[model samples]
Target chain A: MRLTRRDALAVLAGLGITGGALGLSTLDPTAADGDGSSGDRDPAETDLLATMTAAAEVVYPSQVTGVGEFVETYVTGRSRDASRQAAMETVVSELDEIARDWHGAPFADLAADDRDDLLRELGVADSEPVPEGNVSERVRFYVVNELLYAFYASPTGGRLVGIENPIGHAGGTDSYQRAAMDGGQSDVNAGENDG
Target chain B: MADERARAPVADADVCIVGAGPAGGIVAHRLAESGQNVVVLEAGPRFDGDRREQLEAHVRPGLDGPWEMGGPRDAFSSSGESFYPLNAARVKGVGGTTLHWQGMVMRLHERDFELDSRHGVGADWPLDYDDLKPYYAEAERELGVAGAMDNPYAPPRDDPFPMTAFPPSHSDSIFAEACERLGLDMHSVPSARNAEPYDGRSPCVGYGTCKPVCPSGAKYTAESHVEKAEAAGARVIDRARVRRLEHDESGERVVAAAYTTPDGETHRQAADQFVVACGGVETVRLLLLSESDRHPNGLANSSGVLGRYFMDHLFAGMGGRLDRPTRQNHVGFNTSECHQFYDDTEPVNGVKLEFLNYAGPSPVIDALHADTWGDELLEQLDESYGTHISMGALVEQLPRADNYVGLDRETTDDLGDPVPEVHWSIDDQTKTALSRANEVQASVLDELGVDVEWTVGPDNTGPAFHHMGTARMGDDPDSSVVDAECRTHDVRNLWIAGSSVFPTGGAMNPTLTIAALAVRLASSLRARLS
Candidate 1:
């Protein structure tokens, strides 16, 4: 199933969750369909996310599986103000246009290698200013990077990166390497001094 | 009647100390104990044990785990492109910034006192190491520091620490093993947090929020000294921000201090002698703000060097995944520390590195290391949690006249005063030292059998609230703001305390050194008053 950004927002709001970032619930165990699809979604959001996924995959291929979903989750979770919602919509539209212009075919239909080439070009092009009315290269780069960082750093993303969740306390450990060696030497010295 | 009603009468005292942090508090306590009428003026609100808990709750929302600021996050510097927020919790309470400090207390290395003599960089302190040794001992006793006095790199000491070092936690043990494998000496970290009760304060419960106010009185703060001073009949007025120094016609001595209460009511407090113990930034700010014809550049800035030579310890973190899961994941915090590389000198220069050990990756900061997506990332994170050892390096920054704090005309704080504009750029030599420290840290971690995952980029440099040397001390009044006694050269009765008087900040934390200096200043003030 597919979902539109608006539809996602409505669904999230109905569930009484509000924020600018996706939490654990969006990837709930029960919410997962047997086929690994976002079950029973409208066609519009799916098409939009598919395009975004294609563009993001080219930029960060390692994150294709979850990056698009996290971005959508973030956009939907943020304030329901028209300006913000419109900005998200514009981002989706620009991704679709960039994908189509880079490749002769629709983004979802492009091969992974082709997508990667286009993304590299976009990244390089993004280092400088683009023509007015076109999405600034830095903004595109930032959105892609932010999405990748936020997702990978998130709980689910951390699992993917192989970083464990909070395993212990912060700033509570003495873990200085010098202190440990000194401890051993001190013990030996204590024995020697005892004689 | 009209003139009398317009101005509040100045109340005289034996001594009036600005700020109530470590230095100010100690000075007040010592002076009051010496039967002097001491009045301490603190700009921050009064924070007792009960009020501390409330302050914690107010700040808890800001400490949303690691990688999050516990209060209103300040905007990133306009000059720097990095979005990573620089959050230094400045407590406007009686304890000052010590209220939210990690209670790591170590005296400045003996070599640190004579930087100019050794390295020919900054001016050597007028006083020598031996002169400050007794005061260092007194400060340690007052703070109830716990550690082994057997540090090879440490300077000569007359006595030992009050208590034994705190036991190493699980992570600390693993890190210690790694240090041992690398042929580096490690020991229990010396901390201001009580290992066992000494004074009236309780021992540290190992609560993770040491950067914030400690709810339990385990951590020593300036408020403790304030309490002692008050009990000895020293009045401490909170929320009183001193505006300027009111002087007589001679301009050689400070007659009184004009301060504004929280209600914006102005009053003048007269004293026989005045001491400016306000922290580095505020001390310089106040001096510069107190402009008069006698000293145009600022009080005690005759050499035209009042606000110069700012320094802060530069910190860098390097981490990698361990070969196997150790007991590091089992503990709340680490207790072991590494100081082998502290005085490690190259062919040309020496560099210092202090080990910063944590039990686990903070929830938010851990994300920086995670993969963009997938099950493999999760697996890696899980394995790394127990098997990872990260090393943070705190290197000494050379004092440069360029790095300074001044009032920003454009920016202002909530109080309508000009916000402090910090202009600090490290030199190539300091940058080289930082890089070398990273190299040593990585080598140490690798020797521990940890898989090299990633290191943070080089441009990620920020001060950790340990700002110092804005008002440095030197023999010459023209080159330095204060003299060896921390007294402003221009104003005979005016004195500056805390790290502001430091000519150079060593690699170690500055709290202990500040406390020692405060005690020394107290002695000087006591002799004068008596």
Candidate 2:
């Protein structure tokens, strides 16, 4: 989970994000997750981070590694907004209340399968993800959808779906100019050796 | 102390340029390079921070948004048939809106100069494209343009672009096939971005955030000229907003540029000659704000045409998902465009089609907004995100006196000056053009076998942020603010640059034309001084 600069570049290359890393380590902030620790963050913020990370495990693809550190970094960064902080807290508390009533545990403390079942039973996945709407909508909006967006938006998760260089990342000209091969699944080895 | 500061000249110069944008940057560099004492007053600050860090922050989700570009300092209102997002379209900083521009730079077609003479609709430019041809070449060199000479529909060029054209993106190749099928000539889009290492700046490393932010600084911003101007001995003052132009007793010449600093201290910049290059909206707003008894309408409004003839290119788009991967958001800027419909006469005046490199919702955004979650959401993104393809077109909007930028009586900015009230509307001609452009785009998309998802037609068209024709140039002083030389008809020493003086905005991007006119104006200013 803790990658050196060279290792991060190697990982980025392996992910098909960039070919022959031209100092594009900044492309994926999570790729440079040193120590993988939330150092000196506020206690309440840490709690929120934990809740979000727990939720991310259930929502994210099973293949996606480092869900904890990734969600922690993303959630901590987004918590700068007071309203977003409050919204996360509200949603987490609502989920925790449901967990306590049904499964006699906090949502973060519940098993991943049980948490997934609860989310499904609550219709959180089916509900419209309105930011200011009801509990299910808020859960869908702030937790499920937000975490999903963060994962795929990252170069690592984007590479899973043929997005070699997501939107804001600089993967160089050859990466974009090279046509996709074998349907839309991006030939990972096609232009890796080219300039 | 404030009164004392107000009376003292901030800087005395042979020439004073306001707005420090593409126009002012070019003029300042040219004049200062000629050994003239030039001073530029910019309303915005220089973004001297680490651009890579800034771009990283910008790309991050759940942040306030990209680039700390606009705020209360750039407040403006709009009221008409259609709403104009004025602040979103502009940046009031050192490079101006070019700092965040999409870097597409194309020369105006020869017929664009004779809109009235040829089409008998909009007013004709006093000077033709031939007049600007030399300056256009010079501007291309200065901005480090890259283009292919394959655009058969483009106006005749005496010289090739300064750099080689960038190869088409993977998506562009996909679109090109469809375009070829539809008999649309898709050629390389001329851009102000670097295709190779020409200037000191690096070639495009494809940071992909060309608009609002270019992390690698490959895309040309007027800040380059501003820096060159400074090195050539021009005094550049940032965060100094020019409130108004003050004329001498005769009112025939502008004597001083009265501006306020960020510290709320007012100072006057004395100059022998002045140039206002504050884009379109703010240019009119500044002139309107300087209303005096001698020229009660405004300093340059003796002809009563100062704030009239507002123009912006209306955009039409159609987007859909092809079964195969179109590879969306790969290059961030368009690499190919179609100018075949530019001179069309029937449904629209002019049109330029672009095959967008960054099409469809970003993977993150699509995942975030998808109704499904977990496995279903990932499946949806895999199917939808990369497969999305979109085509966009710029439709010509003829200048109308009623669509103008005037002083907003209600809203005031951080400087307490009345903000610009934009009265904008889409005319029937423009609406018809949008509809026609959409039809053409639909045919191409349909040819590609794309499942058409969304289409932006007349009802949902918006401006491409190419503000033009507020202070139109003409031969007659009776009907125009500036003459053929871009000098104010009323004030002999006052000059106007940028697209604001354009009589007709062709369906091309205006930055290249703006740079061309800036070069010409610099030559004119140098001649007057000599």
Candidate 3:
């Protein structure tokens, strides 16, 4: 049966889940299952993923989840990547300028596969002389990581990747109940009532 | 008039106190009540609840940013890059950092104080849980804690709490039930936030912004004690940054202290005795700055251990997805905790874990998480905002000499004072402890039938705002900065208060313990005066 947001939330609540996971389940995109991993993607998605993985491995060599698809998905959704749009635009502009210098064409006009290769080259070039007004490589890495980490580690990403959101059942007394039960006599509670 | 005149800057008082946070506030209140004329010198401005602009400046960027001591126009560049820790915005005001603290009060279990005796590592404090019990009780009464006293995990105390535990928010109830089902001992977290109309303060409105400053006065701050001290006739000076302590040629006694005011004028205030209640970092920095020919390595550097053994709690997140939705969109930020991992007698020497209750990431904070977003992401955010469970462990860090704080020669604040250069690192024991805690967290989530996601690692293990131990206390002057009474070994008249005196970084929050220690010191000073 089709589930509405409210209905899904109720089911989640009934099942004893709470917080961001419930919100995410309700907003689950119809195209999520298209790629069998909860979102729609072009058939060329595999190539993009491979490229992203290679770059992420170099950037966050110690990090285990170095997949490019995961990083792209995270940047597109959870991160404040859009807020860094101005910075992204500068990078894109520099890429276009580089393309014009090399092939006398705009970056967008290049074949999709070629575009990936060019982007990879830009990422790997340690000390390449790019246009003066372009974004720095450090800024690119910062933006990419910020987007990737937020999307992958957030409550939403936890749900998609089968990472359990611990808020629901990890053992503890709610502060109010502890306070109610203990009467707030804890050490920090000392000298609290002189007012 | 006679008392005021006699109390005014005598050659010396019995005890000179420093700082006015939990330790300083408590010490001052207890000593003043015992009839000691305690002089508290705070570098920050006096907190006026009406000062909206000053309060707002804390969150904004620049030198006078809310986290900064001077106003936004001041020069406060963050050294957060090399430190890998956010610069703590410490208030130089009367209340100290308590003015902008979330009052999650818990005790360092009996095992914590006896870490050396039990674990065969670290220096054991001269005093133990038993010695501090009465003081702890007195502090709780003064702080007006609202919690149950029957916690099995907590050490034994003499008296009960003033009031019953505050009611758990709707979200807390769900988390508590889940914990019990998993066989973990969950208890009410002791907070400085009010649960009832105690001592005239109102209950918390669940405003969520308890860090910068509690507008409602529901959270406990040293300002409340300052008011009490004022009512009892203790004089307080604000906007006065004590530059150094002046001594006579003999160098046997402290003559007076020199201070700088906000108006760029220098003034010398003569006092028979002095206390250093500035924070851990400042207290050490001040001593180092007060270098004299008689005592070269700063005020009390004879031992050469004035600023060593610094430590702070290392935090890690344990997150997972539950089978059902849990209430995440709740008002209260944290109301419950898992205290089962508190005691170290069970054989773990390095770290301990606690479960924090509450969910739903704020928009800005959500952006920090790279994994959870998009239409598919929104589905998870919505589903788990209230229903998800996230538990984190505030691990106990080992006392390493390398993790100490010193004055940074290159970076100076607006007043030309050197900013604190923190040198911090973790040892193998700490890493092992964190890994063990993470494993337990995973097991607990599995029991709840939720999908486990992120656990603590090198990238995720970051420093919390709760910084401590730059100036530690011990029985021997050769090994520590301060003594059991929070007095500096080098300067008899100089006392150090606040979490800086902590010999070992405990798993629980440090404010309550700091307050209790302060109160105990104040009482000691009063007795000596009498």
Candidate 4:
């Protein structure tokens, strides 16, 4: 049931969570997933998402509502696409290989700071042997960016940017200036404002 | 009086406006306000706040959504490239294509009207920039255009813009400095949006989702004018696909138009005057479909040029990491443009430099292009998302006789109407413009101390949705479809509006131009009918 923002609105509306709030979705990122319940993730699938979710957590670090659950579901949706799944598998395997070579353990098992350090090291490494095209960039854009947006993608992130109900989000809250109704004010407003 | 005698009229009015886009809406509003009966037929459904939210929801999840800005899919487009050759994210219905437009409201350069005299390539417009200046002002007033008065590149006007330009984003400052260092002129992009609430619309909150949908109606759409038209006593019928125009004997003037409803019922609407603003493609399709015993080659094809000279802008650009963190794409996006090359009439021609708008393809999407996805891909999105700045050249496309739209008699629309077969190609001028664009890209990036990581287009450069010239307006009846007033040469009372009458595709979005011309046409029709 990977609910869209529209569906999430319906569910939230049912609960009377009706104020135009962005953090409402931030409170429960996993609410977008099928059934709005976190108990249904397959153990194997959860394990696969563990590394990506942890990496996303490092980017924003739960500043508001926990983004980990929402990210897992978002990645789950990506993994469902065959092309995305292939790309993720290639990049995730490469990341796990790098972690094992660096610390004798899988990437998902690394300490939170250690995971952050791994990303930072890879961010600036001069001679790291991981190929830099598909696996290299996908690691950032696909896995990390999507994971990072899991928090930023929610209504909560839009509020931080001063837009309580950013367009493209589920909320339809409007914030307009009253004078826009006077369609005939052609020159007065034009002369008053400076670019 | 003519409408009262009609037997089974679904609707009837003094003027019947086909296509409830910016052009149709403005004409309806003007005629209705002048005490003339007007009926507007829109092929798309009406758009409102709830619909905006739903469309906005489609844009929420990155670029991997069903449609950009939640616009409906074009069932008849040719998807042979990364983007459709003719139209991508082009909309139909009540708000019309403006529902998904990015709200760029720039006027054509004054020189654009005389491209034939200036460049010796395209046909000259019947009216000059000064002739359309008043209508442009009226259109800006109607659509709420925010602009800067100091920009030398903008078209000169008597009054100031309706609103001041949007405040500079962090990216705008960087882009300005880089452009200055590179010796290129740049300024705030004149936009059809409120900088601070006006006309009951909220100022732009910089949500960066203008394409495909304006989530908060902060941006103007045809729906705004549609509402005004309705308020002025104009009746708008949505989801009414116009089939063909019926003309009187001698093929001199149009009498009525037949349109089909969503439920497959046909109805005839007669009016004293008729307007066809069915975008660039459908307008030609309708004319071709209206061919009768007297006019065998299409209703307005006496010169055999009704479907000829189709054109759209060519987009080419380069992007790389900025010297410092701009954090630009987060808000007030696409607010800068450089028109230094826009007035060039010689070798370089008009090449508009628009500041970076949307983020490029994701690493995975990019990797798919490269045929591999590796480990370092994750970090690149961060490096590029906020860290990179880009500029693109929107090169002017000179109208050519070969690029045309015609009826593909083999295919039919959902309503059994003939589909439009778009025949467009990148001409030599576009090729020259591409070469110049590449040089422009190189020089700008070098001055900014950024290396060109990826360059898109020089050959087969992407299609810009500013479709124009299928039924171009010119002084010469020998080589044009319509007169200077956008009225068809073969038909007396039938007029063409929108970009379809553009003699040349200027390096600017055609929405404002279309609205302005529609306003001018409305005045012309009012005078004629009064």
**TM value for model 3:** 0.67
Compute each candidate's TM-score over C-alphas: 0.68, 0.84, 0.67, 0.74
Local distance difference test scores for all models: 0.61, 0.80, 0.57, 0.67
lDDT of 1 by residue, B1-530 (tens): 55334234335689998898888888999898889988887776675424233422422221133222223212213222222122453565588777778788887777777877876766688888888999999999988888886577677898889988776554556666667777777666677877676688766543344566554456777778888998997888877878788777888999888887756678888999999988877787777777798867766677776667777776767777665544333223235555666655541134445544453454323333332223343444454455566766676777877777666657655555555556677667766777887787787877776766766424665555687889888888668878887787778898888998898887888899999999988888778777
Docking quality tier of candidate 1? incorrect
lDDT score, candidate 2, position B380 = 77
TM-score of chain A taken by itself, candidate 2: 0.70
**Which candidate should be chosen as best, given DockQ against the real structure?**
2
Q: Answer with 2 or 4, whichever has the higher DockQ.
A: 2
lDDT of each residue in B70-148, candidate 3, tens digit only? 5432233333223534345466667878877777777777866777888876667778888888878877878878788
Please write out the lDDT profile of model 3 over residues A1-195, one tens digit for every residue.
111223222222212222253344323323345322335533333333333333344333232342343444432232122333344444545556776776676655666445545555655223222223234343233333333333332333333332222121111224323212222211211112223
Candidate 4 per-residue C-alpha lDDT over B317-354 given as tens digits, one digit per residue, 9 for 90 to 100: 88877656544334324767777777775554578887
Model 2 DockQ class: acceptable
lDDT score, residue A154, model 4?
41
- Residue runs of model 2 more than 4 Å from their true location after superposition: A1-56, A66-110, A113-150, A181-195, B1-9, B53-61, B68-70, B368-373
Binned by DockQ into CAPRI classes (incorrect, acceptable, medium, high), candidate 3 is incorrect
lDDT of 1 by residue, A19-87 (tens): 223443443322555312357444544664565555555444253354455445544343234453445
Candidate ranking under TM-score, highest first, comes to 2, 4, 1, 3
- Say which candidate scores most in lDDT: 2
**Model 1 chain B, poorest ten-residue lDDT window?**
B72-81
Go through the candidates in order and give the C-alpha RMSD of each one to the true structure: 12.1, 5.6, 13.5, 10.2
